[model samples]
Target: MKSGDKVLETAGILVPKVCILGVTITLINKTTEYS
Candidate 1:
């Protein structure tokens, strides 16, 4: 149970970072395409 909780906590921290990174990359690509 402790290990599962730890994994969930780590994922909770990482998921937002990963999502932000993906959004940034997409925005950069769109900007490049438009320019």
Candidate 2:
């Protein structure tokens, strides 16, 4: 149970970063495409 909780905590922290990174990459791609 403790290990599972730790994994979830780590994932919670990382998921937002991953989402932000994905969003940033997508925005950059769109901007470059338009320009």
Candidate 3:
């Protein structure tokens, strides 16, 4: 159970980080495209 909790926590952190990174990259791409 503890191991499962740890995996869930790790995934929660990683997923958000990946999402934020993806959003940042998308915004940068749009900005450069418009520029």
Candidate 4:
């Protein structure tokens, strides 16, 4: 149970970081395409 909880905590922390990074990359790609 404790290991599962830790995994969930790690995922909670990582998901937003991944989401923000993905969004930044996509936006940069779009800007470069337009330029």
The full ranking of all candidates by TM-score, starting with the best, is 4, 1, 2, 3
- Angstrom error at residue 35, model 3: 0.5
Off-target runs (Cα >4 Å) in candidate 4 are none
Cα lDDT tens digits for candidate 3, 1-35: 69999999999999999999999999999999999
Off by over 4 Å in 2: none
Q: How does candidate 2 score on lDDT?
A: 0.99
Q: List the residue pairs that clash in candidate 2.
A: none
Better candidate number, 3 or 4, judged by lDDT:
4
lDDT string for model 1 (1-35, tens) is: 69999999999999999999999999999999999
Worst 10 residues of 3 by lDDT: 1-10
Please provide, for model 2 over 1-35, each residue's C-alpha lDDT reduced to its tens digit, 9 standing for 90 to 100: 69999999999999999999999999999999999
The alpha-carbon deviation from the true structure for residue 32 of candidate 3, after best TM-score superposition, in angstroms, is 0.4
Instruction: Itemize residue pairs with steric clashes in candidate 3.
Output: none
- Candidate 1 wrongly placed segments (more than 4 Å): none
lDDT of 4 by residue, 1-35 (tens): 69999999999999999999999999999999999
Instruction: Give TM-scores for every candidate, taking all chains together and pairing residue i with residue i.
Output: 0.92, 0.91, 0.84, 0.93
* lDDT computed for candidate 1: 0.99
What's the CA error at residue 9 for candidate 1, in Å?
A: 0.4
